[model samples]
Target: MASKKKKAPPPSPQSLGLPTGGVETHAHLDMEPLDAEVGAVLDRAVAAGVSRVGQVFLGPAAYKDGKAKFADRDDVFFILGIHPHDAESANGVNLDAIAQAFHADPLIKALGEIGLDFFRDWSPFEAQRIAFREQLSLARELDVPVVIHSRDAAEETLRTLDDMGFADRPVLWHCFGGDANLANEIVARGWLVSIPGTVTFPKNEAMRRAVAAMPLGAMVLETDCPFLTPIPYRGKTNEPAYLAFTAAEVAHIRDIEPAEVWHATARNAAGFFGLTLPSHT
Candidate 1:
């Protein structure tokens, strides 16, 4: 008998109907040796329809090739800030320098990935608080939105914002992992909740519920790439192109078509970052 030919495995259902003009809101393209050669990386991203990527530029050590990587590229905009871990390192001169940079660079759209991470406690609570508040002040001073990262310190983080009145800017709880109640409160306050690949894991029930119940306008999509790879690509190094995976998963959870999720999320990112999204092909 002739041997039967092997059948090709079906493509991931999650990969279907990917929208063009997709934007990745929280890609850390400035993270280390990877930052070097990000031009080729971004070239690939553009070819894949990810035309815009918001890069969060960190310290001199992190951006050592003299002025953060991709600084001149128009396709890559940035949110300038000192991360919470760098709290102590952000001394007087450095703080003034970054503020001056932001004043000069209009492309620096937001202040972010800047908040508390009690999980790591890389910086002391007091120092993190001071740095966080100062950046929030700078963001508000500049009329730009702020991106926040909270870990086990959510309550304190929120409280600090409340006290500092830093909650006024268009704040996004990036890669939000808070519970439903907290999510609801955040949405109620008109803040955006960004969902990353963690929402796709079977065990991440709370996150799934949060996304399912979140209002369409209050949601934004992100890959948090080089981390949080979605379903089929989970555990792999992610890229901006993989945002389609996340948008599809969010659509599935919300029982809507992927395009619906794509448009709304794109609109949210554009509105939040003040980016003008290019038309999809």
Candidate 2:
């Protein structure tokens, strides 16, 4: 019988040696493996050069349960929204609860990771559409940026955003993995594209090319941690600290210094989240 091989430990973000200033615009720190040691994880991120992070809560309960964890973590902002996977549960009561959560928590920067997920189709297409529109209305009402999660439904997603009047709005296309053409379309609509760790994969040449083609000002970096760990860290559990790898990969694609991409994306994320980037020591 063949022996099972152990996975290699990921390189520390500190080893990458990029300047501190990177902002991880998306992450699920409240989730398992990460939630257990969220404090240590954030400390590692600080050492890794990531100056700030966005913690996404999938629902109101998640928001209520996890908000206390980051209470003292000034660098960690909050994003609460319903995922398409849970679209069917987006009833009026739940939407109201989401709204109330936003009203109660000024730190909740945006409404998102909410859009269609045709790839999974975990919920009915109709249910996803209704939930998406309802949440978009809430976002518009709350006047916060919207973070999108479109999978195998980009065209439809764009169509919906257009129909619902999100043009030139503070919208972020999260986990973008398209080519330059789609990237251009997104930029033309005046929305920001968030580049995820997948950009470091050799198999995602299109994503690399997209990074090259996108204007630095219109792009941001994200770990989407607990998922999409970059390159050398590909098989390990991802954390905000690993955003340096994604930034370095983006820098390589754009033929610029990693620090440049790091800072520029930080600004983009700051603008999207409606917060100012603090001066780091």
Candidate 3:
């Protein structure tokens, strides 16, 4: 006889108790092996009260899968752009194709996962810059926000944004790892910053302080799932359902109630992504 497979335990009520109007602003569901289990994952997130998920549309493969998935849900929204690492995948016509996809799908809300990445030059740095600027221009034309990914290139990223006049539109520095001073500047300029579960890591004192002092309106919570799983779940594949841990940590750092953090961050995300918030009245 074949051995029985072990099933993952159901989410605990505490883990499932998301505050009203909670939203998951970033995650990569249906993007890879993760796609195989997305249904169960979303079922769990819904059970946990996560009302919205911002899916990302990257290169050709991601865009195709994203469109198919986008076809299935009223609750899920998407971002369309080439990722920095995949900058080489872009060409003049590919850029046109990406913008066309965004135009074709009103469900595609923003241009992003675009920016500079000097950490791994998987794609040439110049290609990354060109792709980044092209998307920024496209975003300006489309009147949509940009989801930025800056790694080992913060100054360059901000400088590029400045050059492109990104100040006129909303920009989210996703999974921000910058210090408080950078946070202050970014927040002062009215750009939003998203915090990931990495803030709860034992050594990120700077990130903790930044999260604690961040203005509620300028802050959003993201799991950056299958990557930055928070504290106790640190080594596992992150899911949107794990946002409760993230909210609890943010609440602990700010010394505020978790529900309050949930409410504010949800509102910030809904506003940033131009999604409708569930009516509190």
Best of the candidates, TM-score? 2
Question: What digit string (tens of lDDT, one per residue) describes model 1 on residues 16-66?
Answer: 756567678888876644566688767766665566888776753443343
Which residue runs of candidate 1 sit more than 4 Å off their true CA positions? Answer: 1-15, 60-68, 279-281
Over 99-135, each residue of candidate 3 has an lDDT whose tens digit, in order, gives: 7887787887778889989989798999999889888
Q: What is the overall TM-score of model 1 with all chains considered together?
A: 0.88
lDDT ranking from best to worst? Answer: 2, 3, 1
Residues 1-281, model 2: lDDT tens digits: 99899987767789889776779999999998999999999999999888889999998888888899998888889989999999988888888999998888889999988999999868999999999999999999989899999999999999999999999999999999998889998999999999999999999988788889889999998999999999887888999998999988898888898888888899888888977676752
Candidate 3, residue 218: lDDT: 93
Candidate 3 positional error at 212, Å:
1.1
How far off is residue 90 in model 2, in Å? 0.9
> Which lDDT value does model 3 have at 225?
82
Error of 1 at 167 (Å): 3.7
TM-score of every model versus the real structure: 0.88, 0.95, 0.92
Model 2 misses residue 21 by how many Å?
1.9
**Between prediction 2 and prediction 3, which has the larger TM-score?**
2
